[model samples]
Target: MDDQQVGAAAPLAPTERTDYAAADSRRLKIILAGEAAMLVAAVLVVFVLKIVTGTGAIAIFAAIVTINALIMTWHVRVITNRGQHQARQAPGGK
Candidate 1:
């Protein structure tokens, strides 16, 4: 591919992640807590359903998938918010 083509495929510099761990400290902890709570809730729900219905392995697999989806959605939101936060802090964002 030509340089222009390659450049087009690359993420914009502003959205390119330099650090995954950087964000408002307090907010980051809150996000972590929320994510953890979600994980716990998902697992608890799956386990409870399995026990109540005797659904066995399928229920466990469903729980894993559900929990993974929840976590992934949360992660995407966190990243987007973090990027927006960073952008707002940037001089041009104002």
Candidate 2:
């Protein structure tokens, strides 16, 4: 086999792979939207709590928000891992 044949037979670099680009873009959009929605929900929850329970409730509300943020982060991690696994298994994927 010639050098040209060997080069042509080489696998594409991970960055050069396009099999999952579209799906990855969609997943990224979903994650971003989900995170934004979560933030909005947290703010609304805190606002409601304050309105009904006064400033003294802020600490509890903040704690709840923190827990929710942690959960959201975990969800993002799951989404990323699943995407990476799928990409690795796809034809011509990294």
Candidate 3:
């Protein structure tokens, strides 16, 4: 194989891989935290301030919950992918 091809095929060192995974986990955590904060703020706006009422309020909450669910779904996929990558890099992995 050419040098470029060989380099492309090489796996990341354990430290680099760990650093990447750690960064990804941290980012996901930050995103989830932000989502939580936003949901709390929405609650305050809808219920405490009474800015929205009845169906409108319900719709707002539903939208926020749906967005949160989508983010959680993506988060799970990222975690699963990371686990699979780690397993593939382990000794005796096929």
Candidate 4:
């Protein structure tokens, strides 16, 4: 085989695989951190409201529902966008 064919058939280098793994890990960490931050902020808001307004269990329940809804919305949007992007990159996509 010619040099070009040989090079094209070569598997990814160890460093290239490592780089892809590291990037995926970093992205996962960042996403988790953002989610945690949102939950923490929601807890803090609920805590302060409970102390000041003396709102009961319903407020906490509402806060949990709101946070879950927001998270679900975010995930759905991300999934949709990723699907659209992949479709655009597929063969014969316009």
25 Cα displacement, candidate 1 (Å): 2.7
Per-residue CA lDDT of model 3 for 1-94, tens digit only, reads: 4434544546657776678778777877887888788778877776743444445777766777788778778887887687677758644444
Q: How would you encode candidate 1's per-residue C-alpha lDDT over 1-28 as one tens digit per residue?
A: 4445543434345543334335444556
Per-candidate TM-scores read 0.43, 0.56, 0.62, 0.47
Q: How well does candidate 2 match the true structure in TM-score terms?
A: 0.56
lDDT of 2 by residue, 64-89 (tens): 67877787788778767877766675
Q: After superposition, how far is residue 26 of candidate 2 from its true place, in Å?
A: 1.4
Largest TM-score belongs to which candidate?
A: 3
- For candidate 4, the per-residue lDDT at 27 reads 63
Q: Write the per-residue lDDT of candidate 4 for residues 1-94, one digit (tens) a residue.
A: 5434543534445565556556655665677677777777777777887788886746685868687668857865675565455445444434
Clashes by residue pair, model 1 = none
TM-score of 4: 0.47
For each candidate, the alpha-carbon lDDT, in order, equals: 0.64, 0.70, 0.70, 0.63
Q: Quote model 1's TM-score.
A: 0.43
Worst 10 residues of 1 by lDDT: 9-18
